[model samples]
Every structure is written in structure tokens, then in C-alpha cells.
Target: MSNAATLAGGFPDLSKLPVARQAHWMRWFTAAAIVAVLLAIGRAFANGQIEWSYVSRFLTAPVILQGIVNTMVMAVLAMALGIFLGIVVAIMRLSPNPVLKSVALGYTWLFRGTPLILQLLLWFNIALVFPTIGIPGLWSARAVDIMTPFLSALLGLGINQGAYTSEVMRAGMLSVDAGQYEAAKAIGMGRLRALRRIILPQAMRVVIPPLGNEFIGMVKATSLASVIQYPELLHSAENIYYANSRVIELLIVAGLWYLLVVSILTPLQMLLERRFARGFSQTAR
Candidate 1:
């Protein structure tokens, strides 16, 4: 029975045996239970009191198509405005002068502190305060006429987005090496030129991921414009439901469209991230 004695006697050794594989029965049981619950949920939805036919009918309707087009248009325009303001505010925040820094800080605080919907409403009703807005005597127009639902939504969304984007941009700028800034100065380059040519270019690798996520969030946030009568996707869906009273069905259709848009943006974001991270190692990315 002694393995050493048996080995000494020219018998086969048993101490060098292979390790036994574990079955992990509990893990298998947990996974199976989760799958069973998911199946039950799917079955419930399949038999739910929803009119799928209406969803299909309005899925490609002309109004729905136009709504989606408007949604994309606003998203792009608002994001462009946001990016521009963000860069300016970020630079101001980083500037050496006290006035510029304080102004930038105040702008960020005012916008980021309030509700976006409230801002939209304020812009929409700005005529109540200003009445007729113009260059004193040169020209005059009703504030209500100039600040339509489209313009109100644009100003509110774009300005609010700038407040948040400014922080993102500042963080990206700070991530760049101080040595790089000094190097730019060593060549007699000014702060703006250094940032434009050197610092910002390097910081982009770190900035793109978060910026892409924010853009995706902007796409979803466009739905909030519906409250102001902007004819984006959710507004159009609500119009159909308001007429026929198929509330859940129309909501489901909107949800599906939102999901589709977000899904497409996710892959595109990944592509942008990869493009910016080209020089970095896999682990760094």
C-alpha cells in the first residue's frame, strides 16, 4: 500500500497523477435557472395584449420617416454647436486670465445646474420677457416668431450640451503631457497654436470614447424636444397613438426605432475609438 516502497520495488509510481477536473454543478444550475426565467419572460411578451399590426403599418410611414430625418438633422446640428462651444469654454477655463476663467465657470454652472426641459420652455416663451427683439431701431421682430419650436430646441439642447462637453474637453486637455506643452513653447509657439497643433491632437485619443458616448446620448435626448412640439421621432409616434389610442403599440414602435439608432451608433463609436487609438498598444486601448 506504500507508494514509495512499491516504486522502489520497480512498480509504477502513482504520486504523479493528473489533477481532477471540477464539475462546477452550482454554476451550471444558476445559468440554467436564468435561462428558464428569460424564456418565461419572452413567452409572456409573445402573448401580451399588443397590436403588432399597427407597429408594422406605421414603422415605415411617411410621417415616421420625416420624423427620423428631422431627428438626425437636429442631433447633428446641436452636437456641432455643442462641440464648438465646448472647445471655446474649455480653453477659457484653462486660460491664465481671471475674467475668462470666471466667465467660463459661471457659464458651465448656469446651464449644467438646471433642467434641460425647463431651459427649452424658457427659450420657447422668451417672447413673454423680451416682446420684440432686435437691434434697437435697425430692425425688429416678435421674439415668438424668431424663437420657433425648432430654434428653441436647438438653443436649449446645444447650450446645455456645451456645458457638459466643456468638462469632457477640459479633462482631455489635462490628460496631455505637460512636457508636450513645454515642447511647443520651446519652439516659440503660443498657447492656442500649441493646443491646435500638438496638445489637442494627442489628447484626442483619450477624448473620442467619451465624446462618442455623449453623441449617442444626444440622439436619445432629442425625444425631450417633443414636449416643445418639435416633430422628432417620438413626437410623430405620439401623434399616431393620440389619434387611434394604441398607446403601447406606438410606444413599442418608437422604442424599436431608438434601439436601432443606438445600436448603429455603438459600432460607429467603436470605429472612431479604434481610429484614434491606432498608435497605442492593445492594452492601452
Candidate 2:
């Protein structure tokens, strides 16, 4: 059974034979089952008691439009406030000063520990605790007047988001190599100056993905503010359903809008990730 003798005898070459593809019966079956389930659900929705007409009508309603606009406005402002506070808090968390570090730790613990809805409710009802606020001699206003639903929602969402974003920022800063800090110091940069110029820029790449996700979450979290009468998308939908009693249709309209917003944000997030990840390896990106 020598190879040379077998070749001379004109036997077929085993290496050149076509390889047989294995059948993935289980995979095919699973995929088919999933499709069947999805179709069944789709059929149920189509034939359900839901009024498609109401969904279509309210989809472009003035109140619904306003609600979506408010939702976006709050999302942007809250995220901006969160980012600013997060940066400051993260820096303090890493500070040598015990006071600063403890304050930062306490802030994170307090906000992150509380349920978001509780925080919203507390902010909405803050007037009960403090009847008035402002500089005592110069300006004073009723707490209820100052802490309107919009302001309450903003403070609740932004401050809560800051606690979470601080951790994200701290993690990004920690991910930078120790040598980078040493290098900055070697070049005679102050800690804050080095952080502003060298560290933060580099850390942006690490933090952007999570930040985008957090922003998307913020958009959805605005719905929670509805309980406090903040007039976000869900609130608008609720109003419609209350007046017309078309609960499912109004909810479907609201759900569609949320989906649309998230769908748009997802691609934008990917773009931002790509932008920040420009110099990174393909796998890392």
C-alpha cells in the first residue's frame, strides 16, 4: 500500500474528493419554528380588537407630536447635564481629597440606590417638603412654581443619570494605561490639564458606546416621567386613551413612535462608535 505504487496504479486521490456537507436539521427546525411563532403573533395582532384606525389617526396627532418633541428635548438636556456632572464627579471620585471622594461616593450611592420612579415622584412633590426657595433677600418663589413637571423631570432624570454616568466615566478613565498618566506628568502637565487634554480625549473612545446606550435608555426612561404629568409620549398616549377609551390603539401608536426613535438612534450610535473608533483595529471597532 505504498503511495507511489497506488498512484502508479491510477487510484483516485482521496484529498481531491469532494467533502460532504453535514445536514443541520435542528438549526433548520428551530429557525422554522421561530418564523411560525412570529407569524402567529402577527396574525393575532391583525385580527385583535385593536382599532387600527385610531392608531393611524393619533400617530400624527398634535398632542402625540408635542409629546415626542418634549421627550427629545428632555432627553438631550438631561444627557448633557448628566455628562457634565459625571465628568466632575468622576474626577472627584479619583481625587486625593477624602472629602471630594466621599461626596462623590455618597452621591452615586444615593441616586443609584433609589428607584427612578421614586426619585421622579419626590421631585414632583418636593414642594411639600420646601414650600419656598430662592435667595432670601433678593428673590423668592413657591417651590411648586419653581419645581414644575418639566423642571422636576429634568432634575430627576439628569441627576440620576449623573450617578450612573460617573461610573461609566470612571471606568473609561481607569481603562487608560498607567503609563499614559506617567507620560503626561513627565511632560510637566498638571493633573487637571493632563486630564482635559490627554486623558479625556483618549477615554472618549472607550466611553462613547456606553454613553450612546445610556442616551437611548434616557429617551425611553422619559416615559416614566408620565406619572408626574411631564407630558412625554406615553403621557400623550394615556391622555388619548382616557378620552377615547382606545387603550390598545393609543398604546400601539406610542410604541411605534418609541420604536422609531430607538431605530434612528441605533444607527447614529453606530456612526458615533465608528467615529471615535477610527484609529482602532477593525475588531476593536
Candidate 3:
């Protein structure tokens, strides 16, 4: 019937009220599009070449487990080194001295300008340029002996992370109120003492969230180390598939392991955010 038709109560039908039918129809169309994508994914998974049985068989293989352990270790070490470098660079960035700021800026610009894969390759093959690396007049070690896959990967990933973490650290430090710094100085704190004892503790509230994300990202980014023959999770999966030719299945296993690792880190990240954010409740009397 026409929307203008009067009801028994002498009121036009409810459809007479203005409504956006196009958006309503679009919602259903969007749902249908989602269903189509899902169906496509299902079809791909159902392909005979996927080999679900092989995926299940190798999911927890010993070598794969070892790779996972290696991945975790690399992520932790890289993130720790990155955090240290970030703090140092951030302090330099904040310093009033022009020389310190320039040095920090140069380091940041050079590292960020280089692609990560190139950095990894460079570190792995650095022995070609520098036969030995050590403090001059103290001792020296062969570059080839020191720059193993693990060490090279750590240096590349960690140094790259430092460039990013430096910005995060500087932002967090800037977030703290200027009054807090003045107050620390008023209380007989030296500049370094004030930063260490008063400012950084409070800045942690701002810093911890993104720092947690950097850690989790480092975990995922560790996959890149596979190119260096670092034997991380993805590399281990490749070794298996290379022998058996079960490429997709082994890849699936590696993906599942990565998902599991990320899933664990996600909750831990949330917990740390919450912990650092204590005392921020607006309702506090």
C-alpha cells in the first residue's frame, strides 16, 4: 500500500516517516560480501594440496619447537637492546647541547633510511669489510667468528627497533609535565638524578604501552631473520617442507605458531598497560 494511506487511528503509516533505505540495503550487501570472502577462504583451505594431515603431523615437531624457542630468545634480546639504544638516543634528543642532538639525529636518520633486509644482509656479511671487531688496543675478535646468524640478526633487528623506540621514548618524556622536572630540581636533584629518579618513573606511564607493542612487533619481525638462515620458526618450517615438499602445510604450522605467540603477548601487553596506568582513575577522591 501507499505510505500516505491513513491508519485506522487516523495517522499515516509508519513508513511515511523519513528513513534511509539505501543504507539499510547496503548493510545486507556488506554482510553478503563478507560471506563471499569467507567462502573463498574456505574453498582455498579445502584444496587437496593444503594437506591438513601433514600440518597436524608436523605442528609440534622437535625442530619446529626449537625454532620457536629461538624466535622467542631473539625477540627478547633484540627488544632489550632496542630499548637501551632508544633511551640513550632519546636523552640525546632531549639534551640542550647541539652536538648531542646532531649525533642522535644522524644515527636515527641513517638507520631509518636503510631498509631492514639490507641491514640484516649487511650485518651477516660484514666480515667482508671488517675482518675483526673489538676495542682497539684492548683485544680483537674475528668478524666471521662473532657475526653468527644469531648475533647478526640481533644487531640488525635491535638497531632498527632503536630508531623507532627513540621516538616513542622522546614522546613519553615530553608527555611529563614541566613542573615535575622543576620540582625535582627544586628538591636538590641534579639533572641526571631528576630524570632518573623523578621524571622517568612517571614517564613510564606513557611509555609502557607502545613499548609493549614494540616487543610484540619484535616477536613477529623476528620472522625476517629467516633470510639470514637464522633458524627461527619460519625457517625451521621451511627446512621441513623443503625435505618433504609439504610447503603449504608447513607454512600453516608456522603461521599457527606465530598466532599462538602473538596471542600470548597480547594479553601480557594489556596487563602491563593496566599496571602502568594505575592511579589514573578519575573517581579517585
Query: Which stretches of model 3 miss by more than 4 angstroms?
Result: 1-23, 282-285
Candidate 2: 10-residue stretch with minimal lDDT: 2-11
Instruction: Give me candidate 3's TM-score against the actual structure.
Output: 0.90
The per-model lDDT (C-alpha) reads 0.92, 0.95, 0.91
Backbone clashes counted, model 2:
0
Per-residue alpha-carbon lDDT of candidate 1 for residues 213-277, written as tens digits (9 for 90 to 100): 99999999999999999999999999998999999888888888889999999999988888888
Q: State how far residue 210 of model 2 sits from its true place (Å).
A: 0.4
**Each prediction's TM-score against the native?**
0.88, 0.90, 0.90
Instruction: Indicate the TM-score of model 2.
Output: 0.90
79-127: candidate 2 lDDT, tens digit per residue: 9999999999999999999999999999999999999999999999999
Clashing pairs in 2: none
Best-matching candidate per lDDT: 2
